[model samples]
Target: MLRVLLRTNALDDRVRKTLVDTLYTQPTNLAIGAITGVLCSLVAASYAPDRIFLELALLLTAIAAARIVMAVMLPRLRNRDARRMELLYEFGAFTYSAVLGVFAAMTVWYQLPATAQLLMVAYAIGYGTGIAARNAGRPSISIGQMILIFTPINVALWNGEDLAHRALAVAIVLLWIGMISITMTVFHTLRDSVAAAETSARLAEKMQHLARTDVVTGLHNRAGLNHYLVEYMSRRRAMPNLALFWLDLDKFKDINDALGHQVGDRVLSEVAQRLRAQAKQEAVIGRFGGDEFILACDVRDRREAETIALAVLADVTRPIRIDDDRLEIACSMGIALQPDDGEDLETLFQGADLALYHAKVNGRNQISFYDPSMSRNLVRRREIEAELRLALQRDELSIFFQPIVDLSTGRIRAFEALVRWFHPVKGELRPDEFIPVAEETGAIITLGNWITAQAARAAAQWPDDVTVAVNLSPLQIKAPGAAMGILNALREARLPAHRLELEITETVLLDHSKQTEDFMAELSAAGVRFALDDFGTGYSSLGYLNKYPFGKIKVDRSFVSGVNAGKKSDAIIRAVSGMASTLDMQIVAEGLETIEQVQAVQAAGCTLGQGYYFSRAVPDYLAGMLLARERERLDGPKRAIA
Candidate 1:
């Protein structure tokens, strides 16, 4: 038992409980032990009753036993740990005995002769000294210490007188020990329990903090942001002008693709640091996910809001160093002013998203202010969204396949399926007129899936050498389960990925790092060809070419339009086409309306061209007729009649 107690750590709660329970049950055993000790003392004293020695011993035994029993049982009845309660009970027990012993010492001096009193004093002194020395090694200082110090002095005072006086003095020493024991047991128990409860409360608070704070960057996560947002918005009635700045890092995927994910995480940490550095005191910044972050602040004026936006743009655009490489990471910020954008959270959030889209469209790495025109765009988008749903149902939409030709060989390589909305009221609505709306409303996932399936089905009927190109919205790719949807669509259509080319805009590769990388890697591994569509429009074209895996780059219509105009735009076109060639990527120039535009693209070293220079986007039957005419020409006699 001693070995086991020595091996057990006292702080272990299980061991402590066992020790307390032992003390609680000790009251019964203590009573029997005390009675036995008293009877033995009486037996010895009966032989010398005149000496009064047995009476003194009996009195000491009875008082000690009664005090021990009361100290253990009282706290147990109160549901307290008996070990803790016993120490507190002993304090009072010892103090009371000290006063009683003094009173009895006076009585002993008055009653007994000198020798018997001296004997009583010596016994009391020895007992008290023994008790104090034993208890000093205990876990706490109880009433035993007071008994040790005072009982010895009281014994000396009584023992100076007669034998009768010695009996009273010993009885008083017993009473003082009992009183001290009770006080120590009760008070110390209360103190220990309070301390334990406070420690537990502090631990609980720390756990709550860890749950709310982000482990990596120490910023708030989506859950924490939502919690705080709800708390702040609860005071929305008083603070009406709450602004939400939805920020997405520009070309973040390109960085991840060029460097490893570890470096990408480092860049993200830096981005978070920049945000906190640039943020105003009132701003609450949090990571939404990947390279996306949110800045929520209560603003009262437009100028102040714009100032914050500019500061954020400036800070994020600063150069970040990872090992030896210094990278300039930029962000596109979209501002949605509250109550003006919407009275509620969801609508305001949508408005901010719309602004972000406008920022990327106009030119990324810049901030775009929310305007009423955004609402007009949203409305137009909604109408197109409604049409988009009904277009397939009512057969108002059809695929128009435009042939992709090799400029040098003049041979058809692929057919790009462009969707046209033949609106009943608004006749001949082109994709540009409605595709944005479809993407915004999250209907593009369905529309894009259909287009991929349709393109695959068409490619299956064509020559093995020819491929089908399908335009995919960034939003479609961003949505969860996107890769699964693409895979299932291809499998259902029974078309190999090699026969399908997915055209995605440069903006799609900007942010949403983890999602974009996963999607591209999965699809590319499956053998589907990808093209960087509308290049030279967003933040960085050359950077993307060097970063992502792409089969082709389609020059945006804006650059193509300017290729005919001046040296500046023409130089840009030439440089872009040359860059693509150097990278071993095919160049497809969009919006080739005239012979000059086509010739200019060809002059710029562009190999593939798609525009009205060939033919406008026509109906499916007309496109098939065009395909048939081209095939027949290839199979027919040579053009030279020498």
Candidate 2:
């Protein structure tokens, strides 16, 4: 019996309902046992003289009321997980059944009528059966209930001092033993069924957990993220102000390819841990697989979301170190604010994703928010990227020539070749729009080679003294066969290398790679002069001027545009001009939009000038006519002086 009570742990392992169901029939047994006790009390009271019925009725009433209370409370406890409370209900039922057995025993001890004794015997037998039915789920408790109901009655019958009573007790004891055996069988059967059901439920729950979890980071998986987003959106009808940030790890693939996946996996885990630490507890952060992670938080507006996005981006870029190698990671975040970006999760995420594309395109490791204008821009960019591919093959691309004049004489000494795209359907797209798309798609290589060929051909057709300047993208300078491409174009067009000048931006000088250095060296060695374009706007150091052999420096138009404002602009131009003179390099002052601007650059000792003040970039045929008129003007003066 103590063993069964100590098997509380076993009961804990069982389903809550198993124990609850075991007590389902308990209420009925309690009521039936109490009724039998009351009936026995009534029979005793009726037979007794005057006052005996009062005490008897009072005792029966107390027992019946207690039984009624327990019966009501026990049923309410069904499916309750509290095992001790369940055991107390079971004990109450056992005690009530035991009292009923004592009632039948009392009939033999009190010398009641022979018919009454037979009735009491029958009542005890019925109560015993009820015990078996009620306690089947608990074998040890059933044994205890059976003992309480049958033992006292059997002992009283045997102690009656008659052969007939003794024989009746023996026969009833045999039946009682068989009931106990059946109770044990039923108890084991019920317990086994409960265990099996509980095990199955637990297994299913574990499978669900595994499906929604990421093994590497223990964060929510992509499916889990989607599930969370669905739950969040469902509750966000009237108050749908949430920020969704999609972060992509910059240069993560390089680590995976260079250091093996193990190192990459470690890095990803670290990133996840750091992000979790930095995010608010209510925020939902999850891995969307690979190098991308998604974070979401409910906020009032874009400013709140932007703050979170910036914090997350900063968190993501923290350094991760393994062994001796420390990797500085960077993340670009695209933010979309709900109700502002979109009401639904799908539309919001799409906006965020497009913004992410712009972040990576504009220069990575930064955060950007979604704007309606971005959608239009993205559409146009997509159109340009698609058409630019076809434009290279279809020869739909053309060129415009802007003259670079000698600052002293205003002679058109050279023409800067600018590429223009005339889309068949979208009309003419500017270089800023299509060139970036082409560069992103690696179409710049083909486009660049074609530009070189075009420039060389045009320069070959011009006067031998006139030169053509072509701008080079950073990607072009980084490419391996860039010098070869330009050299071949010049050879094919029968143009002299001296007549073709390649202009490069400060970014090309800052590449720091041997590839960029070798490319510049190769082209310079082949007689193609280099001009530093947008020199002062970017990180133009004096060291670069001494290191790279540039034939000239084009002062960025931003400073040139501000020339008339104050001496500040003139001061910068003078400083740049002085540096160029010391290095024995020419200066081409760009963006000379006014005669005052031209005069400022000329006074500041600029060797060349080019802007709208001279003439806007014009078509090839018009450029040739302008060049002819300028040449005639310069020669007419030369002939008069001679």
Candidate 3:
């Protein structure tokens, strides 16, 4: 019974908030009701002039005072403190209903002027509206309040000694029953509306959770980790002992490629389980993306954090069986401690990432802590990337050409264009300084196109026997419509595709698709010649030689750099030259700095050579001068100054 009473009385936050909002209109309603009561009292006094007259007037005045007091007090309380405010308002409301019930029964108990009945009817209409407004959300209160107002009226009507008065009492009882039905319906509608709102809010919260969670591993995704990081940093002043571990599975791609992604996914799930088991209840473990996880730990000392990191690495690398085969895993982790590495999340992540990179670069399957100087190289790289972007837009980048000589004839054959950067503050930057940076940032596509156009235009002015060679980044050919763009540039320059040689590495074919094969075929059909650049350096060199039909093979400088001192390089060069001869492919040996090195490469049957010994890479005008000298030699000249 106690539980039932509590359940009936309790209104939820939403309903209580609604009740507070409706109470703001109570003041005006009470004042109007008070005025109607005064008029009713006057009419009753004129009719009675006796015992009930003064008593009725004072009773109405008291009820009006109680209502007016509630009107003034109710709206002042905060909506959040709704239970106390609602109780107080309900007490005032009960009093008003009881007093008004007695007033409604006045006509049956005492003789009154006909106009006094009119006043009572008007007061009852206002009373019914108040019940609907206050008690719709609370059905028990509506029942009690309505009963208090109408019970006395029914009693006074049935007390009369006549059929007409008894019939009137029956009619009032029926009407009260109808009002009770309306109260129950209104209560149900309000309850369902509140329930639906609560349900909707809960479903929205679930959707937010799914958005931040990883589906496969069931760990916090990058978004979820970022969310925790923001909250953690916001209160970082209070909790200063924290460390983040950017954990990576070393050479995990090899597993995916060799065993398949399905096996890889199972391994990842097992890894997540191990991390969760190793992590403390307070530690946050998140999937940083594929094959990578981040562990955030709360520890006072760096040694404690390092211990935890080592334990996690040990657990991750334990031999685990997948597909009935036991396999060993390797993991690399980078740790960033609070305040020492960074104070902000982005800086912390960058520091941790750089540490992870160093761990991988040194060797896989190890742990490294962040040091301040570790970011100097990263900062410099970022600075170079930023400046390189501006270099392209400002036209501060230019092309330089190195001459490739026909060793058999001792004449200049073709020039290879190399990109050079003119930094105003740093002087000249070579391709070794910025070319890898350009490829990593995808700036090579833009830089490559510009060089191709420039070299093509310069080559358009050369003799038919001479050719212009340009190096293409792997990124440029991998792009969509890349071959078409190169074709368009060459066609626009009116340079025959035969006089243009595109140099590519064997690595380019490692991940290339049939589209790449189709692209090469289209260019080859258009008379665009190709050379396998840096040959014999890649693992799949001989395979690429058979795979791609090349007009030339440029032997990498590593072999030629050791040409004079070693017989292995000489034999390898001889073997490559022999292969090139059988395949009808021209061979160019680079990095000939000494007369002995030049003679070694020439004896190995290399068709051409390029090095500082012949001439370093120079501007377009200088290359044109070298070509003019070659023409003069072909025509009438005996010799020219080297």
Candidate 4:
């Protein structure tokens, strides 16, 4: 039992180290033990005055002095091998207890003076108790010390012929048992506490990591990005030049609408991987939100930032394959430089966002660096967006009509309704000035609905044969209840659905969404004709013409302008007109400003024309007057026949 208790293997390595360190933590405890042991030895020698007693006294004195010296030097030796130091401390403790035990036993066995014997026994018990209390962190070592000290003294008392001495020995044995129990309890308590603390620390670290990581892309999330910014800013003096790049995937929404969100998530993950591969090792990258990513990296100047931005754009635009689909995606990047754009994260983010907006507005899949003018433009846009909201509520918007003429009869077929904002302070604002802002800010839904209703009401006032064409924004087409809303507008105006023609650009077909298909199908079933506007300006696939129920295809203004001037534009118009004729779709030549251009489109088989040559867009009153004039002209021929 003693050998087992003395072995160090019972405690874990960490617990053992902590216990050993605790043993030497209090030099005052070591000093007290040394002083008491030396005094006890001297008292025994003074009482006995024999050769063995004196020699034992001298040896105990030497050992006590050495323990004192060790305690004094402990601080200097703390940096040395811990295991060696722990062994040294244990050896010194055991030797001191063994020597004191022998000295105490001799005082009793030799029948020394009663005062000396009592003193020695009392000293031994006191020292053993002290060891139990002080060294309880290491139960084995503490119990071992108590056993060595008390066993010899108890043996000497039990060997005596006196009854009182044996009773004293039993009492000492009880005391030793109690001390051992207490030491074991203290050691277990301390060990369990350390284990709990370590466990909590590990749990806290894991939770922190989870909080900072993005689940979808396995990159840093917004919170993680904030953390990175804080840490980087702390060391900003060392790294003065930082380039913040904001990236947005162009037409990613089309992908999500056409495919699904699951595919969108996969694409985002792939994009993250590509960014990781292309970014510098020191760069901190994060996914800010849907389809948006941010990167902060060290760069010397705008030139280096531009170079990196171009490289990233090139790599990201490469084709990606998912399942059976080969998707080619493009990314627009905006860069803001540190100290030049802003010193902190908030300002830097604002600058980068402004630049990104500029890139998207100019053309997607390009890079823009921050400039002061972009900020002014952003402010102007915000003013427009805010005022435009009020404009909708205040009825500061109106519609104008551009007539589409039939080339064969030189008469009006339909009038396209175009929205114009008459700002009180800014006068009449063109659609191009505020329409993009409305579309981006989600105000187009309400505005587009208003236009549809107003156009329906105005068409009711026009000649029964003249139809009203209203252009639909991509947002308006994708909005819920869009078809129902248009039908409601026509119903409220008492206008037949046949008189309402909807003009849509090719962008609406890019999504290939079920909602859009359903929207078109519902409206088409209600006798609302659909025209493919700006037909050749976008993804001019003949597939759209075949898939969608388009009654008319309007040649883009660019092609109409080039007619009779270049063979390319003329050839494109001729081919489109021939295809439309085959599909039984009317072809309208747009942007015609000259008789020669009009004749060219007529000869190329275009049945209709609309441009400045016909008439610029006019208000509803003027449109009604023009329809009345056309009606009178048709009546004049009929009256002549009468």
What TM-score, over all chains together, does every model reach?
Answer: 0.52, 0.69, 0.63, 0.83
Best by lDDT: 4
lDDT of prediction 4: 0.88
- 346 Cα displacement, candidate 1 (Å): 6.3
Query: What is the per-residue lDDT of model 4 for residues 17-135, given as tens digits with 9 covering 90 to 100?
Result: 66677777878878887888788788779889678988888888888888778767875763655567677777888888998998999899999999999999999999999889788
Worst 10 residues of 4 by lDDT: 1-10
Per residue, candidate 2 scores C-alpha lDDT tens digits across 1-642 of 466446634565456556555665546656766776677667765664456444645565576777578657756754555566557656665665566667667676665677767776786687677567567776666777778878888888999888998998998889888888787677767777888878888999899888988888888889989988888777734434888888899878878977899999999899889889878777788889899988887876677777777777777787878888999898888888877789788999899998888898778899888889889987877878777878878978998899999978788989999998887887888888788878877888878888889878887888988999999887787677888989999999999988899898887766466777888788888888988898777597888888887989998888888544457867888998998899899999898888888888899889999999899988788888998888788788888889
Q: On residues 63-152, what C-alpha lDDT tens digit does candidate 1 reach at each position? A: 766666675657546466645654654554464345334423433444444454344444444434334433322323333445544555
Error of 3 at 93 (Å): 16
lDDT of 2: 0.80
Q: Rate the local accuracy (lDDT) of all candidates.
A: 0.70, 0.80, 0.80, 0.88
Please give the ranking of all candidate structures by lDDT, highest first, separated by commas: 4, 3, 2, 1
Give the range of the ten consecutive residues with the poorest summed lDDT in model 2. Answer: 48-57
Q: Give candidate 1's error at residue 418 in angstroms.
A: 2.4
Runs in model 1 deviating more than 4 A are 1-180, 226-242, 251-262, 298-300, 338-354, 357-363, 371-397, 402-416, 421-429, 433-616, 623-642
lDDT of 3 at 292: 89
Sort order, TM-score high to low: 4, 2, 3, 1
Error of 1 at 134 (Å): 30
